[model samples]
Target: MTQTILYARVSTSEQDLSHQRTQAEKAGFVIDKVVADHGVSGVSTRLAERTEGKRLFDMLRRGDTLVVRWVDRLGRNYDDVTDTIRTFINRGVIIRTVINDMTFDGATKDPVQKAVRDALIAFMAATAQAQAEAVKEAQRAGIEANKGDVTKYRGKKPSYSRDQFQTVIDLLSNGAGASAIAKETGLTRQTILRIRDDQPAAETALVKWGM
Candidate 1:
């Protein structure tokens, strides 16, 4: 019998593992098991290097399905992510992502289909790496800007935590309105607008406040 396993990598204590699982379940994936690495920096840690990540390799078998929040969860960067996904597919383990409802299968032998799938994989992996680099750069800049008198760097502290800020950004990317996001995240409409209008500033605020 085949099983669907959900894999999550939580970078900080603020990140919610249950939120990832909830998102996957909401996407209609009937998960048989969940493996997670807590407080693991996905940007710097290879999948195989993670404790739970290693278990994924040993636990998964041919015909099993692996689900992740995004391609970035699979590895540290473009090469690592692409290599990891390819490795799973080659092992007859199907890979799926909740964010984009993406599926990768190695069972397909059609040349055109294979080409399209490979191209998509490369594009997504490259995008994931690019986003990670951008966030790292932003955090560096934020830290520099807050070198002295961090409280004054961004004025009043933000009402939201890093995880809440992330949730707002995710919803905004999906075209959710400020009012809707405000309700969903329990943030004020003004706060949502502020974050939507100036995301970098919001991120800087979070960093300055050590959120």
Candidate 2:
């Protein structure tokens, strides 16, 4: 029988693996198994280079499905993401994303449909790379901004970590209420509201504190 597997990459040890699983389940994916790489930098390491990520290529069968939080989980950059998706699709594995409920299947013989799928893959992969670059740049800027007088511009440290801030952002983007997000993340409703009110500022606060 075919199976569905969820693959997650957490950048820091503090990031929660169960949270990714929960997000997937909440998005309606009935996962049969989960493979994750903790403390893995998705922006620097290719999927094939990851410890648990390599297992995905071996464990997945042609009829099985591979699910991820987003395309960025599959690779380090645009080329890596595109190549990885095409490789799986060519193997007859259906790839899906929880974020947008996006699907990419290679079973279609129709040329037009294939074109559309390939185009979408390229677009998403490029977008993932762009986002990674943007975050990297933002972190660099934040670091530089506080280098000279750490006390002067550092501002107050945020109560939440980087991962928690990201979780709040993701939940908020999914239309989750402040109370629900606070309950899930173990954060105060006021903090959730603060994040919801200004996501960029929340992210900046986390980066400023080096969280």
Candidate 3:
């Protein structure tokens, strides 16, 4: 039987995965399993290198269907996203996105169809990568624009709420390591370190960005 699998990636646990699962269900997919990588940045981590992501690759078989929230869930880089898609397709696994119900398959025998499929894959991958870069650029611009108003500006709103940040601080106060805090709170290890090192600055960014 051709099993259905859902792959989800989130940089923080604060970000909900249930939404993605709900989306897949709404799209009429019967997911046999769900594999997710939490607190891992999509822009920096390749899908194959992620703990749960690697397992997904191994669990998938020919004729199985893999669903994701979007192309970016597979990867945030152009080359990585496209290459990962190609790998799954080559394995006879059908890739589908919940965001658009888009499907990519390599089972087509026609040369023209294959070319069109390949072209679409490249275009989507590039677009996903561009979007990720655009977000980073926007954040940089926001910070640069506010450098002069440090006193008035609190910083971008953090991804974690005030209470959540307090929890991080409390953990750090106990001499907990970054990795430990990350595992406990679903925040990235880098985030934990940032909170531990310069909490005021991190809090300011959180307030400014309203993250």
Candidate 4:
């Protein structure tokens, strides 16, 4: 029997894997196994270099099917995503995305079909990369904007709730490094650092905004 495996990756712990799994299930995937990497930035780490991602590469058989919520979950760069999909396809694995039910199979010998398939893969990978960068840039911008205006900012609605923010503060109080706290809470390193360095200000803003 051909196995159906779901590979989910999130840069922060705040991101939920259940949502991705739900997306896959809604798209009619019967996942036999799930492999995930948490609190690992996709932009900085290649899927092949991740702990669970490495295991995914080793465990997937030739006839196995791989499912992902989107191409971005597989990688953050266009070349990396394209190359990773190609490598899996070359091994007779079917790669499918839940978002569009996009399928990539490298089983065709026809030159025209191969070209079309390759082009689509490249486009999708590039799109995914662009979206990831956009989100990061937006986050950076939001942080910068909030830095100058305490009363007007209120911390851009926060990525985590008050309780979650409190957890970050507690970790910092315990002398945890920003990176360590980020890994522990599934938050971005920037977020961890900001809360760590300015917990008092953040707490004030949270209370003021009732966040």
Candidate 2 residue 169 C-alpha distance from true site, Å: 3.3
- Per-candidate clashes, comma-separated: 0, 0, 17, 1
> How well does candidate 2 match the true structure in TM-score terms?
0.83
Give model 3's clash tally.
17
Q: Candidate 2: which stretches are off by over 4 Å?
A: 148-155, 161-164, 175-201, 204-211
lDDT of each: 0.86, 0.86, 0.78, 0.76
Error of 1 at 106 (Å): 0.9
- Who wins the lDDT comparison? 2
**Candidate 4 lDDT trough over 10 residues, lowest sum:** 202-211
Q: Say which prediction, candidate 2 or candidate 4, comes out ahead on lDDT.
A: 2
lDDT of 1 by residue, 51-79 (tens): 89989888989999999988989999999
Query: What lDDT tens digits, residue by residue, belong to model 2 across residues 1-211?
Result: 9999999988766657887888789889999999999888889999999999999999998999999988999999999999999999999999999887899988899999999999999999998898778767766776687788877556888998766876787777677899999998899999999988766567656656656
Instruction: Sort every candidate by TM-score, greatest first.
Output: 1, 2, 3, 4
How far off is residue 95 in model 2, in Å?
0.9
Which model scores highest in TM-score?
A: 1
Check candidate 2 and list the clashing pairs. Answer: none
Query: What ranking of all candidate models by lDDT puts the best one first?
Result: 2, 1, 3, 4
TM-score of each: 0.86, 0.83, 0.72, 0.70
* lDDT by residue (tens digit), candidate 4, 104-162: 98789999999999999998888878756764565566568878786555545667655
